[model samples]
Target: MTSPPRPEPRSRAAGGPDIVPVSPNPYRFRTGRVVLVLEGVLLLVLGVWGLAAAGEGTAPPAGAAVGPLQLTTAHAALLLGTGVLAVGCSVRRRSALAVVTAQAVGYAVLFLVGLVGAAHEVPTVLGFDYGDAVLHGGLMVIGLGLGMWMAGEGLEGLWWERRRRASRSDDHHRSGTSRSPS
Candidate 1:
C-alpha cells in the first residue's frame, strides 16, 4: 500500500502553529565594532604622538601639542581598552552590553581628563596651550557621543533578543492547545 502523505508544516498565522522565526537585524553588531575600532585607532595615534612629543622635550607644532606623557597614558588606556572590548563583543556575538559598558566608561574617563587638562592648563612635556586644550575638549565630546551610541546599540540588541524570545513563547503556547474552540 502507498504511504499517506506527510502533513505540511503549519505557520504561526494559521490555525495550526509553529515557532516563528525572527527576522535578522539589518544592522549587524559589526557596524558598532567598526566605529569602536576607528575611535580606538584615533586615540592610539593621538596617544603615541603625545608621548613622542613629551620625549622630544620640544613643543609640538601648533594645534598638535597634546600635553604630557601623563595625559597620553590616559588616552592610550582608553583606546586600548575600547578596542579590546569591541573586538571581544564581535567575537562573542552575544556580549554587546559588556562592550558598550566598557566603551562608555572609557569615554567618560577620557572626557574628564580632557576637561582637567583644559581647565588647569596642565602643560604637556611639549608645552600645551589654550588651542591644544580646546582641541582635546572637542575630541573628547565627540568620543563621548560615539560611546553613548555604542551603548544604545547594545541595548537595542538586547531588546531584539527579548522580543524574539517572547514571540517563540507565544507560538509554543498556541501550538500546545489540542484543538481550536471555533
Candidate 2:
C-alpha cells in the first residue's frame, strides 16, 4: 500500500495565521479562588471565636463540656495558621499546589484536634462527643477533596495551554506561512 503524504510544518510567526490560542477557562480558576477565599475567611472567623471561647469560664448545664474554654488555644492557632497560609498563597498567585497543601494541613489539624478532644473528654461549651468528632472529621475530608480537585484543575489548565499552543503551531505550518523569529 502507498504511504500517506507527510503534512507540511506550520509557520513560526507570533501572529501566524495557523496560531489560534484557545482561551483559558476562567470559571474553574475563579471558582477555586473564591472557594479558597471563603474557606480562609471562615477559618479566620472560627479562630477568633475559639480564642474568645478560650477565655470564657462558664460550663453548660447539659452534657459534659470537653475541657476548659482556654483549651481551645491550640485549635485557634491551627485555624489561624491555615487561614493565613491560604490567603497568602492566593495573594501571591502561587501554584494550586500551595493552596491544596495549605488546605490539607488545615483540615488535618482540625480533624486531629477534634479526635483528641473527643477521646480525652475535654469539655468545651460545645461539649466534646462522638457526634462532634464525626462532624469535624467529615468537614476535613470534604475540604481535602476540594483541595485535590483544585490542584487537578490547575494541571488541566497547564495541559490545555500547551495543547492550544501546539495546535496553533500546526495550523501555521499547514497554511504554508512563514513564522516570525522569536
Candidate 3:
C-alpha cells in the first residue's frame, strides 16, 4: 500500500492566506550606491584641483576661480573630507542613509551661505560665487531627494515586516499550532 501523501509546503508568495509583504528593492539600493560613489569622486576631484591652485600660490587665500570651479582653502578641505566620508559610507550598507542625509543638510547650509555672501558682496571664506551656488544647489537637491526616498523605503519595509509577523502569529493561534507543555 502507498504511504499517505505528504502535505504541500506553504510558500511565502502563495496567495489566499499568505500575503506578500512590501520590501526595499535591492536594485534601487545598488543604484543609489553607484550615484553616491560618482558624486563623491567628483567632489574629491574638485577639492584636489582647488587645493592645487592654492599650493601654487596663484589663488588668493580667501578664494579663487579655477576654470569653472570656485573655491577657497576652507571649502576645498571641506569638500575633500566630505567626499572621503561619503565614499566610505557608500561602500557600507548601514551608513548610506545617514551619509546621504548629512550631505543634503550640509549642502543646504552651504548654499545659503553662498547666497548670503554674494548678496553682501563680501567673501566669507567660502569663496561664494555663482558657479559655487549652482553646484551646491544641484547637489543639495540630489542628496535630499535620494535621502528622503531611502528613508521612506526603510520605514515601509519595517511596517510591512511587522504586519507580516503579526499575521503569522494570528494564523498560528487560529490553526492551534502551539504545542502544549509536556
Winner by TM-score: 3
Point out where model 3 deviates above 4 Å. 1-24, 158-182
Candidate 2 has a TM-score of 0.55
Taking the candidates one at a time, how many backbone clashes does each contain? 2, 18, 0
| C-alpha root-mean-square deviation, each candidate | 13.3, 11.4, 13.3
Comparing 2 and 3 by lDDT, which wins?
Answer: 3
lDDT of 3 by residue, 1-182 (tens): 44345334345566434433545665667788888888889889888887887667677645767678778888888888878877889976558888888889989988988787767755677778777888888889888877866666555652233223557767879998975579
Best model number under lDDT: 3
Q: Global CA lDDT of candidate 3, please?
A: 0.75
Off by over 4 Å in 2: 1-17, 20-24, 56-71, 92-96, 109-113, 122-135, 157-182
lDDT of each residue in 141-180, candidate 1, tens digit only: 6545654554553345322122134566577688894445
Q: Model 2: per-residue lDDT, tens digit, 1-182?
A: 44345333345564434432342554655667777777778767766776566546552322322332233555565656767665566653344446666556655665676667667644654444555566456547756765665555345642222223557778889899868998
- Model 1 clash pairs are 67-124, 68-124
Query: Between which residue pairs do clashes occur in model 3?
Result: none
**Greater-TM-score candidate between 1 and 2:** 2
lDDT of 2 at 41: 80
lDDT of each: 0.49, 0.56, 0.75
